[model samples]
Target: MTTIGDFMLGGHAACDDLFAQAENAAGDWPRAEGALGVFRDTLLEHIAMEEEVLFPAFEDESGAAQGGPSETMRAEHQQMRALLEQMADAARAHDERRYLGAADTLLMLMQQHNMKEESMMYPMIEAAAGTRADELIAQCRAIELRSAGTCTCSRHGAATA
Candidate 1:
């Protein structure tokens, strides 16, 4: 059984790896540009899966529709997006110092945000949603970001890279 926490924790690790790759390439504008773009897109896609699929389902199941952890998470997501934009701008200007500063801030924020989600939000979602948790997670996994060229899941008869 693929628990919600398991899936989301894996996603957090994947995003972290991508972020590190971008950070490592910060001194090289050519490499940093491409690496950062991938990180940004992948992180955005992760946020979309939570906001569009998991969070909504958890909200409905838990009946905290107006305000709750989901709202808090969404706000943090916005903050992360803003930081990503800053990083992009700094990269475009070829300012490694400014880029690293934003990356540092973003890395700290992401660590905290992911901790809250993994330790509290995801577990709460699993407990509240029960059997439906599986469905919600499946929906999240099924989401293909706009930047993702082709479907890689076996259900679509596409080869996974």
Candidate 2:
């Protein structure tokens, strides 16, 4: 029964953990590779969920803000994506400095991004989302679960399944 914010926030934290582990490995390519894989997928799915579901819901809920939080989050997503791509390239090339550099950027980005969402964005959603909150959140969770090859809600027009 997790909300979209809850689920995606968990994903962001998972990505952070992977980044931390990679940085802690101190140039161990194999260890970094394993952590980097988790970092990659978690970030990808987290962004996909926001863009495809949660952001749109927030936009609908608070046009007064004119998609304010969602817009900022999207920009941050781009920054995170860039760092992730760099990390991937470095990991593939087995370059410790490059990998750690990208990991450092990711850590900063994630820490700030999480703060905005947990403080400003989520409270705004709770205040303004009205009755649609429950339904929209349900749809988002269904999308996540289906994306992970689990439950199939099949309610989101095209496919939440």
Candidate 3:
């Protein structure tokens, strides 16, 4: 049975691939910029899935909004967002060095962030959400589809409706 952990990990894998694509295209400004755009879009969708759907459901189910792990994750998301903007700017300017710097930082941040979510937050969410976990996953999938403007339902291979 597919679980929330599976879905979240799938996102992590996708982000990793996108980031690699951007890195591979670093020598070509136009290609790099295009890759970064797709990476940024995909990353934003992943963030929205957590911030808009998963986190709320977890908070509601666990009642840990005041000072919880979700709050920590949200704070990290903000940091990542800042880095994303900087990376985007660097890409636009065709500053490979600057983009690489920001990409390095973002990659480390994502590594740490993904670790927490995969090991701790997602399990907590799964247990707390119980029978509603599938519903929350569907909502996340919907957000992903909307943000990406494509049917990524095959990625998770899970029921989306």
Query: lDDT scores for all predictions?
Result: 0.85, 0.71, 0.87
Off by over 4 Å in 3: 150-161
For candidate 3, give the lDDT.
0.87
Write the residue-wise lDDT of candidate 1 on 1-161 in tens digits: 88989988877997899899899999899999988987887788789888998888889888876779999999999999999999999999999999999999999999999999999999988888888877887687677434355533232233123
Give residue 119's lDDT in candidate 2 (0 to 100): 76
TM-scores, each model vs. reference: 0.90, 0.78, 0.90
Tell me how far the alpha carbon of residue 154 in candidate 3 is from the true structure, in angstroms, after superposition: 12
Query: Deviation in angstroms for 9 in model 1?
Result: 0.7
Clashes (N, CA, C under 3 Å) per candidate? 0, 0, 0
Judge candidate 2 against the unseen true structure and give its global Cα lDDT, from 0 to 1.
0.71
Q: Candidate 3 residues 70-131, lDDT tens each?
A: 99999999999999898888888888898899999999999999999999999999999999
The CA lDDT at 98 in model 2 is 85
Q: Mark the 10 consecutive residues where model 3 has the least summed lDDT.
A: 151-160
Q: After superposition, how far is residue 86 of candidate 1 from its true place, in Å?
A: 0.3
lDDT of 2 by residue, 1-161 (tens): 55545755676676677667767874788877766765566567667767777677777666754547688888998998999889878988988888888888888888988888877776666667666667767666666566566323122222432
Once fitted onto the true fold, the runs of candidate 2 whose alpha carbons sit more than 4 angstroms away are 1-8, 64-67, 150-161
C-alpha lDDT (0 to 100) for residue 109 of candidate 2:
85
